[model samples]
Each structure stands twice: as C-alpha cells, then as structure tokens.
Target: MRLKVFEFDISNSVLINTQTQTQHHLTRTEAQVLEQLANHPNQVMSKGQLSCAGSQQAVMSESAVAKAIFTLRKYFGEPYIDLIETLPKKGYRLNISTPPPEWQQQLAQRKKLIILASCMMLIAAITLITAMHQYIWFKTAESPVRESRVVTLNNHQQIELIWLQSPKKSSQQVSNMEQKIITAFNLCPIVKWRDVYLAFSNDMQVLNISMQGYSSNGELLVRNIKTSDFSLQPNFISPNWLQEVSLCD
Candidate 1:
C-alpha cells in the first residue's frame, strides 16, 4: 500500500494514511515533531531543537520533547520508526510509512471532537458572564425617580418649578411632595431658571430652587424640596415655603 502524509494549515499537526482514505489528526506539537522526522526519514532530530520548534513557547526541556515523542509512538504503533527510532542521547528519526491501527483512528477522531466542544463551551461561558456584568452595572448606576417642586410668589403670581432628586437620601413625605408638584405643573420647562440655589438640612433633605421668565414676560419660579426637610408642610408640596423659596430669576 502507498503511504501518504498531509500537512495541515496554521498548525503543527499532520495526517498520515496508507492506501485507505481514512484520516487521523495530530496536535500541532505532534505534527511538528513528525514533520521533522519525515524530513530526515532516517536521521535523528536533536532533542533540544525538537522541543523548541514543537512547543508553543518556542522552547521546551529535552525531557518534555522526549515524552511527547514517546506518546506519539505509543499511539501510532509499528512500521510508523514503530516510525520513530530513538538514538539515545543523539536524537530521533522517522522510519516512515507508519500506519495507525483502524481502531486507533476512530479513537483519535473522537478525542478531537471533544476538544472542539470544550473550546466552544468556554467561549459561551465568557460571553454570558460579560453580559451579566453589564446588566448589573446599568441597574445600579442611576436613580429611578426625579424630584421637582413649585413656589407661589404672591396671590396673583405663580411659577412652575423643577429639580433633580438627590439619590443620597429620601423620605415618604418628600416623595409625596414631589408627586404633587409633578402633577400640578409641567416639569423641566423650556425656559431657563434665572437664579438657582441649593440647600440641605441636617436630616439629609435637599432643596433646589430656580426662577425663570415666561414668554408673556411673567416670572416662573420652582423648587425641589426633599420631604426629609423638617420645615416641610403637612401637604409637604412645598417644604419651608420661605427657606425653600430662594429666587432663580
């Protein structure tokens, strides 16, 4: 039977067969060592050079190279030096035409499939982990509710008010006030508030107030008062009417 060897692309592995079309695959390291042997056919390759070329790191100990050669021999079996002939202290050479047993070819194919499956699973796991991390970051990154308030300057004068709620602290009273203000007026008006003031109470309550001008030349003023403020009203819609009413015109 005519023996043939084929080299694989991008890896140090090879396929060898005798007459039959049956194929076998080898790891890159195994293939590189085999190719070196095929070149000399009957000349031994230096253990040092074989280790360096066959390894991913471009260098390996002599003992490591020898172990790899031994494994290859055990797998391929006779006529193949069994294809490698060891020259003790000298190196190794291929006897060529070394064909593996029919049963072994099937076993090798199964091993390759297992390796491929393992790699695919690892990639999937990494992708899933990354997605989970991003989702958690998005969930914890920002506040869900916005805060706003309105202030009446006089019996005939009233203005719309709005502000961003502080994420640092909160209270049910402040929460109710925020809802009332939002319900009473359109928040985030197109016009800019003229003067802005920020205030805070010992209870961690915060207040933001601003004054804006309406197209009618009328003035619009607003305040965002936290319910936590002790000075807040029972309605809590406007906390400490006087203290929270800083002008923002």
Candidate 2:
C-alpha cells in the first residue's frame, strides 16, 4: 500500500501545524533563532555569535539554546533540521525556508503593544507622585501659624520688646519689623528671667505664651503658658498686655 504525503511550504516563518491541522505561531526570539539556522544551513553557529546577532549582550547557555532549537523544531512539526542542523558546542545554521508573512506581522504588533503599555504605566506613576506632593504642600500652608516673642535689655539700659506678628499680614513686613527692633536696642542675648510674673489685662481676651531660655551650655528651658495665673511685674517687662512667666531660678 502506498502512503499519501502532503507538500507544504516551510519558508516564510516558523509555524507548527499539528496533526489535527491547527496552526500555532512563534515568538520573535524563536523566529529569529530559526532565521539564524536558515542562514547557516549546515554549519553550527556558536551561542555567542547567535546572541550577538539577536542583539543580546549575554549569550544564553548551551542547554538553553538547545531548548530553543527544540521548540523551533516542534513548532515546524516536521524535522526542520533538513535545512538547518544543530552542531554540538556550535551554533545553529539555517536549513528551513523563510517564515510566513502573517507570523512576522503578528510578532511586530505584539512588540509594539508591550512598549506602549510600559510607557503608559511610567507616566501614570509620575503624575500620581506630583499630585501627592502638591496636596502635602497645600495642607501645610493652610495650617494655623505658631507665635513667638522675645525681649532684650541692652547694656545702655534701653528696653526692647520683640514679638512675632501674624505671618498672614506679609512676610516682608514681619521681617522688617523684627530687624528694626533688633537694631534699635542692640540687645544682648535675650534671657528669660525665672522670677518674672505674668498677668492678662482686663481688656484682653485670648493669650498664648511660650518661653524658651538658653543656659550657658546652650541648653534650652521651655515653658508653655496657658492661663493668666503668673505675673509680669518688676522681674520681667514686656509691652504686650500678655506676658510669659519666668520659671528659672
């Protein structure tokens, strides 16, 4: 009995037509390997040369390259080695025809999609970080401002009272006021007198006072004044109706 044989074109691209008559496509790397094999036909190309040809910096291991070759053979169904032969310790040569036009187009499309998706993800991450930073800045800008005051007595016995005005007015205005006060008195290191008394005037409503004194060693002594229980009389002097109580000895 004579066997029936079917003739099919193998040149174009690597394709696996199963016994069930189903066609499967190859990836670009696989196709490139097959193309290399087609070019070498009978000679074995080294793994290094093949990797370089594929624009890869590092050459794949021999076993890995062999596996790729095996996959290519399986994809073509029949032994593609008739056109391309794999030489041990050597590279593969082209023994098969070119891949089908449709396969090449599909591979190109897949690569393009991969590149586009990666770019989009990077852009999205950058935009999210920028928005978060802006939100943080706005929150800090909207928070209530903190107030501080300083008073200094010069060697000439002149009194200088310094206080932080509301920053909402103008930064330049506040800065200028502070500079003017500092220049007028030429006050030495402002010291918080411990024996000073604090009191609120009958006309005032709300007052918050914070005092920090530095020791000879540059250590800070901090005091938070809440209500008007302390006095600001002969020991400590300030122009403001509210005053900070001196807690130091």
Best by lDDT: 1
In candidate 2, stretches whose alpha carbon ends up further than 4 angstroms from where it belongs are 1-103, 119-205, 215-219, 226-249
Looking at candidate 2, the ten consecutive residues that score lowest on lDDT are 1-10
Question: lDDT tens digits, residues 1-249, model 2?
Answer: 000111222354435343556554655555556555545545567867665545657445555666777776665556434444666665666543444599788999999999999999998988887878776555434423233344444543333233433433345544554454345334334444322222223322223345445566777666555443254322122434212333232
lDDT of 2 at 87: 65
Query: Top TM-score: which candidate number?
Result: 1
Error of 2 at 28 (Å): 44
Candidate 1 lDDT tens digits, 1-249:
222333323252545454444456667566666665665555668887687674456566667677778767765655453556788778887655556898999999999999999999998988887878776555544642254445543232444444444545446645554455433343333324433333233345444333344445575545343444444333334435434533322
